[model samples]
Target: MEVEKMLHMKGGNEDTSYSKNSLLQRKVISMTECIIKEAITDIYCATNCPKTIVMADLGCSSGPNTLLVSNAFINIINEISLKMGHESLEIQIYLNDLPGNDFNTIFLSLPKFVKNLRKDLCMSNPSPPSCYFNGLPGSFYKRLFPSKSIHFVHSSYSLMWLSQVPHIQETNKGNIYMSTTSPPSVIKAYHQQFKSDFSMFLKCRANEIVSGGRMVLTILGRRNEDPCSKECCYIWELLAMALNDMVIEGLIEEKKMDSFNIPQYTPCSKEVKDEVEKEGSFTINCLEVSEVNWDANTDNRLNLPDKNGGYNVAKCMRAVAEPLLASHFGESIIEEVFIRYRKIITERMSKEKTQFINVTVSMTRKA
Candidate 1:
C-alpha cells in the first residue's frame, strides 16, 4: 500500500470525521499538558529567554486537538515573557502533516482561534506575542525544515505509524497487525521497521532543531515487550476477526484479508528509549508510560456489551482507520465492518477491562 497517499485520519467535521471522533486523542493531549509546559519552559530557561521561538507540530492532523498544543505553547510563553518583563517575543509555529490531511479545515478555523486567543490574553497583558502560523504538508520521517531553525518540536499520537508496511517473507495470515498467531519473523520485521523509521525521525529533527531545543512526543505504545500484547494489537485483532467473518459470509474476498497489514507498530517503552539512544541526537529528559481506558470518556450508562461504551470506541477506531481500510478493502464494506467491530468491542469490554498504553517522552537536542 502507498502509505503516504492513504494514511490519514478521516478528514472534515462530519460525524465520522476525525475532527468529531478524536476525543480520545484530546484526552491524551490533556494527559501530557504538564510535560508540554515544562518542555517549553525548559526551552525558555536554556535559551535565556530568546526573543523569537520557532516550533513545529509534526503529523498535526486537523481537528480540535490539532491546535490545542499550539495554543498551550503560546499561552505558556506569553505568561513567561510577562513574568520576566520581556515584552517583545515572537512565536512562529508550523502545522505539519501528510499532504492528504485536511489543512483547509484547520486554516478556516484559525480566525476564531486567534480571536479567542487575543481575547483571553487581553485580561493580563495588553499585547500578546507576535504569533504566526503556517501549514506545512509532508512526511516527517525526512527533513521538513531548515537546519537549526526550529527551537521546540511536538508530536502527539503519530510516531506509532511506520513510514511503510514492513516487508516480510511470511504472510501473517488472518491478522492485520502483530498478533499471537503471527510468526516470530513477522514480529521481528515490524519491530525493525519501527526502529528504522524512528531513527530517521530523530535524524531529521536533529537537523532542524537548534542545539538545546526541546521536544515532547506522545505515542500509542505497549507495556509488554511482546509485540502482540492486548493493549497494542487487540484493536486490530478484533477488526481482523470482523473482516474474516465478512469473508465467510461472502461480503468480501478472503485474499484481501490475508494480504492486508496495518502500517503501524506500537513499541514498548524500552524500544523507544533504545531507539533514542541509537540515534544519538538527543538526550532523553523524561520518559513515562500511562494507561488510558479504551473508552476514555464519561458516558454514564448501563455497562452492557453492545452499548454506549462500545459504540464510542468503535467510532474512535473508525475515525482513525476507516480511510486506510477503505483504500485497501473497498469503501463499501466499511460501515458493515465497524458495525461488527462495535459488537466485538462491547463483548470484549464486558469480559475484561482494557486500556491503551501511552508513552510520553521529553527530550533535549544535545549541544
Candidate 2:
C-alpha cells in the first residue's frame, strides 16, 4: 500500500472523523504539556530575547488539538515575555501534516482561535504577542522549513509512523505489525526502519531548528527493548486477528491480508537515544515513558456501567486507521471488520487490562 497516500485520519466532521475520536491524542497532549513548557522555557533562557519566534508542530492532524497546542505555546511565550519585560514578540506558527490531512477544518477554525486568543491575552496584565498561523503540508521525514528558521518544534504521537513499510517484511504474513509470532528478521526489519527514519528526522530538524532551540516529542513506544512486547503492539495483533476472521468468512482475500503491513513501529527509549547520539545533531534533555489505558479517552456515555470498552476502542481505531484499511479491504467491509475487532478487543479487555506505552522526549539543537 502507498502509505503516504493512504495513511490519513477519517476526514470531515462526520461521526467517525478524527475530530470526534481523537480524545486519546488530546489526553496525550495534555499529559505532555508540562514537558512542552519546559522545552520552550529552555529555548527562552538559552537565547537572547528576539523580536520573532518561529515554531512548528509536526504531524498536526486536524481538530481542536491543532490550535489547542498552538494556543498553549502562545500562552507560554507570553507568560515568559511578561516576566522578562519584553514588550512585543511576533510569533510565527506552522501547522504541518501529510498532504492528505484536513487543512480546511483547521483553516475554518482559525478565526475563532484568534478571537479567543485575543480575548485571553487582553485579560492578562500584559498583552500577548501577535501571532501568524499557517499550514505546511508535507512529510516531516524530509525538510519542511528553511535552515535554522524554527525556534521550537513539537510533535505528539506521530514519530512512531515509519516513512514506509520495511522492505524485508514480505515474509511477515498473517500480521499487519510486529507481534510475538513475528520472526527475528521481521523484528530486525522494523528496528532498522525506525533507525533510518528517525535519523533522517533528526537530520532535517537539525537544519531547520535554530541553535539552542528545543524540540519536544511524544510518541507511542514500548517500555522494554523487545519490539514484540504486548504493550507496544498488541493493538495491531488484535487488528490482524480481526482481518483473519474476515478472510475465513469470505469477506476479504487472504492474499490481500498477507500483503498489507502497517507502516508504524514503537521504539524503545534506548533505540531513540541511540539514534539521537548517532545522528549527532541534538542533545537529549529528558526522556520519559508513561502508560495510558487503551480506553484512556472513552466518554462517560461510552463507558456506561454495562457497555463493552471495545466498542469505544474500535471507534478510536477506526477514526485513525479507516483510510488505510478501507483502501486495502474495501469500504464495504470497514464496518463489519470493526464490529469483529470490537468483539475481539472486548473479549481481551474482559480478560486483561491493555495499555499503550508513550515515550516523551525533550531535546535541544547542538550549539
Best by lDDT: 1
lDDT by residue (63-96, candidate 1, tens digit) is: 8899999999999999998888887789999999
**lDDT per residue (tens digit) for residues 76-194 in model 2:** 88889988888778999999998889999999999988998888887873657999999999999999999999999999999999889888744677899998887788888988899
Prediction 1 global C-alpha lDDT: 0.91
Model 1 weakest lDDT span, ten residues long: 298-307
TM-score of each: 0.97, 0.96
Considering summed lDDT, which 10 consecutive residues are worst modelled in model 2? 297-306
| lDDT score, candidate 1, position 120 | 89
